[model samples]
Target: MASLKSLTKTLGGKDIWMLTLGKGDAESKPAIAVVGGVEGSHLLSVEMALRFAEGIISDHSDVLDNTTFYVFPNMSPDAYEQYFAALKWERSGNARPTDDDRDGRLNEDPFDDLDGNGMITWMRVEDPTGDWITHPADSRIMIKADRSKGEKGMYKVFTEGRDNDLDGTFNEDGEGGIHFRKNLTYEYPYFVAGSGEHSVSELENRALLDMLYTKWNLYGVFTFGPGNNLSSPWRYNRAGASKRVVTSILNDDAGLNKYLSDIYNETVSLKNAPDSGEQGGDFLQWAYFHFGRLSVGTPGWWVPTVKDEEGQAANKDKNREVNFLRWAEQEGLTNYWVDWKEVNHPDFPNQKVEVGGIAPFVMNNPPLAKIGDAARNHTDFIVKMAKMQANVQLVNLKTEAVGKGMTRITVDVYNGGTLPTHTEMGTRSRWLQPVKVELSLGNGQELISGRKIQTLRSLDGDASVQFTWLVKGSGTVKIQAGASHAGVDSQTVNLK
Candidate 1:
């Protein structure tokens, strides 16, 4: 923490931090940014991020020679603190007051612990018109009643609280304000709850974007959030994806996503992972679609499905709550769920009501004791990713003496790694700086052919672009080729 740079203050006055680790000329080297706490309730994300930074500096310091790292450990400090509050619940927004219901009042109907429990659980009321039903296998878990399957609705589930305003909505407004993950620029969900008044409206979002906009050397962005584009690559939809607004991952970028996903699976051992994609205005999509960088995201941890005596995995129905409860039971995790108990409610008379369900943050995050191992696995994965970044090199140089003391120099600038110097969309958008080739000639030397500096759009993997420069009167000339994100390289030539 001492080595981190405080980039800026969020709207809630929390410091947004960045720890840059690298060797000489880090600004010009290829970089990977590891961000966490994009979703405030995901406390494991913050822990994993911090562990990665600590592990890199303590164990994998050698990897920083050619690679730079920017680790943001906690992007939503205000909302993350709720995990330690006296009354705990899964919170995703920051610490700003918001009129979530738009009922001419601010936070008037916030969540209340009606049962006097330390946690905010669910409240289920027995109503024939409700759309929820208890899971047949595990009564503790609840699922939406499938009307098409002839399943009759038996209950209405709501966050545990009373509608203080009598608006008929339960706990719609809460203490925490705008959600950090829901306030990005790409595919901004306008006018939606938690999407904010406009995209990038929050101080935290603006601060992070400002830093990214200035750091042109960043080639990849790795976020620890709800999205899992790293485990399962996003599928491309030609028509809908290629629209002017661009809803899907670009075809070329989707290929890269698959390539990286294979690397992730090989490096990490966790399996039976859930498939989750980008919601509108998420950091993962914003990194690629708007920031023009190769972006990857993961939750860092999830419970693997438990197996039965016959060696088959339990909960084949794919109900998250049911599967989570079964897994918790198999693991002897008794504290995750609270038994439902009848409770009196002010809003309803002569109706059956109860407050109980899975405790907050347990389903999304593993127990604190298990996070150390998970963090170690993620740290290794991130280091592996850094090794695959674009490594540009200058090769195949030839010098020829032309007529009347003119020397013609030729060389090929190549990308030697599997990844391209820039994403296809990045090249198309022209946001990332193109690879720059420059020649430093000695005193009184004049260039006769090629420009002093040449910018190439992009260099594909194992691909090269040849450049020729004709100069007059040079004893020794130094030529350099690369971009901030591509990793620069240089060669010295003696024109005799």
Candidate 2:
């Protein structure tokens, strides 16, 4: 049976619900934590996580018996509410108030609907010294001038808001606080906007991490957010991985990530998936580097390439905004773009300023119903992943009697699953369980050889390590192997 628990209330008093969707006790089984709403700007990720939870509960209950799922439906509920709020922009933080510009002011220069459309869009100003120009193919989109191509810029772009605080920066300090994506312990960005005063300083950030720490069997974490390492796997770089700060994935876990990425691409098969490379402190990177788990993440959805009249997909290397406009027109998607119109502004009286561009949240988040295949495919992929978790078994138990009352007992600790017991980072972090092979002898029994408890770091998939013990004057003895996440298996033997 599935159960929902609130981790804590967001600053807006929204309940951040964590759902344990599976059979029996979730903590007792190996689990994958499906996290959504890492960034409130990505509303589609929230829909994906919710639909997966619903799909798993209704259709894939049988898979839950072996695998538990901890579903975090939303992490930044405070900012997420802005989607339905009166004035909406792409907000990424929680409700806690902070000087986003760190200028000793709180949201004093927030976004203003210059067009009064009740939505936030871009503001472009025509100026000779500007570094932006209209896209060659689509005048509705803006692109940076490439001096190498002899393109000259004729406009400057900014968010749709004037300098309310007269800081000469438009909408630098927005409503809300730390971005959960940036307020993580791993590679925490210092003094950066939306990175928070310090890492893990926000309530939701602290609460989510604390809850994750308690889940002993959570070996895999799936984060749905801005960064992507799923559709296209990253390569392992020894030099970067060996850095004192560990800037890249370890060699061992890197291969695993590549394998999983292949499976993800095969399962989802979403075309034109955007690979937003990792920045510091995001959940996708933190889960692997800090949490020491098999972590993978993606945006789950992206704008597909528009096809020509002959049904051939256009080259994706084109300007993203122009590409999006073409796809939107082809798909009959409307109201997502704001046409440029001259607006009277206080910031600049002489320059011609216009407010209009692609609407916020429309680029990252598609129509909710468009992701049905994504949810179903992800569900199937995760279910397959659940069945692949490391399983420990005490196999090949044998006992031989010597000429005297002494007897020898032997057993192999084997991992019979696709994934190894511990990830390369998991072993290095020393956070996960270290395997144990223990021998418990009867009152009359005495150990003559081998460690009473043998401990080591890791076990590869389809691999086994043997442990032998010589007992003196033994009656009965019990041999147990393994620890929490990898699982423990025991064997009982009678000695003569």
Candidate 3:
């Protein structure tokens, strides 16, 4: 926090911050934002973000010459403190008091650590009509009973607690408020639990959006969260992803997503990854679908699946919990799970109740010791992505004498990077500034062939647009072409 404060101003109070690193010149340059703590439970996300910032400032500051970086680390500090609290649980939300249950009360029924283990685990009640059963391979893990396979239901699972409000639900309402990831506007899941009253209703969400709306130079966004568009691109849904409203990634942007995914796979070598997809009302989707930028996201780390004796990746058919447990055991991690113990429940006086299961924040966050390597790999990937931003340059200059003191100046403006000057959706939305080409003439000189300034909607990778300008009576003229995100380039032409 001290380092960030020394670098940039604190926005939206102490909870939100913005750091801009670059040449600090008048010319607008392309920028990429690295956001962390989109989910409060994922502590590793915050670590990765901070490490990226430190790494760039300490080692890779040269990239800032042409590129600007906006590092927003730890967006959910209020809820993140719960990880170090006396009684810890995987929490996602802010400090604001919320009536999540709609019972006209705030935080009425919070979690209770019944076993005094200082961690909130699961509570299982043995009932004939329950729908959950223990996993066949690992009894510590639970899976829903498959009714179609004639599997008999055995136990009902719930969060560890009693019904504080007598409403027949345990720990339905907690101390934590709105979840930042669940409060975005794009495809907002209305009336959903933890989504808040409306889209962008929270202070952090609105403040971040406000900052982004003013930054016209931002070409891409990278978020460290549960959404994993970086690891695997979303399947194309022509109708849902490409409508005028655009609930899915636009076809062109989807291609970029896949391109970035391939780059990520080549850079990061951790295999047997878990499924990480976009959930509704997430920051990642909102950045692409609504803000109109190339957005990518990932959890940064996941437990690698256990290997078999045949030197092959095992657990192809195993569920996430089962695989995670086996991997944890192989790694000699004993603190991840709490053994089941008998407990008395107020709701079910005569029923057999037990409290135990996988501990919170274990599956999502790896040990702190392993964070450095992951951070370094992710930093390398980000630097590679930065090098791929569209760099517009003016080339192929030619001048001809056309008589009567008139000259024709022609040049090709090209995009030299892998990404386009503007995303397809960005061009269609007309939200991004177009590539503007301007010519500076001498006194009493007038352009006869082309306008003083011309705008192009977009330019694809390795693509160029030709421009010709005829001016009457000019010693020398200057031409400049580019946009905020394309990195402007200028050239001087002589007409003798």
In order, what is each prediction's RMSD in angstroms?
2.0, 1.9, 2.7
lDDT of 2 at 89: 89
lDDT of 2 by residue, 179-251 (tens): 8888999999998888888899988888999999998888899988888888877678889888887878999
What local distance difference test score does each model get? 0.86, 0.85, 0.84
Model 1, position 123: C-alpha lDDT score? 92
lDDT of 1 at 197: 89
Residue pair clashes in candidate 1? none
- Per-prediction tally of clashes: 0, 0, 1
- Cα lDDT tens digits, model 3, 330-395, are 888879989999988778989999999889899989888888889999999999999999999999
Point out the worst 10-residue segment of candidate 2 by lDDT. 308-317
| Candidate 1 Cα misplacement greater than 4 A, ranges | 308-316
The candidate, 2 or 3, that scores higher on TM-score is 2
Worst 10 contiguous positions by lDDT, candidate 1: 307-316
Name the runs in model 3 displaced over 4 angstroms: 1-14, 308-316
Residue 145 of model 1, lDDT score = 91
On lDDT, the candidate that comes out on top is 1
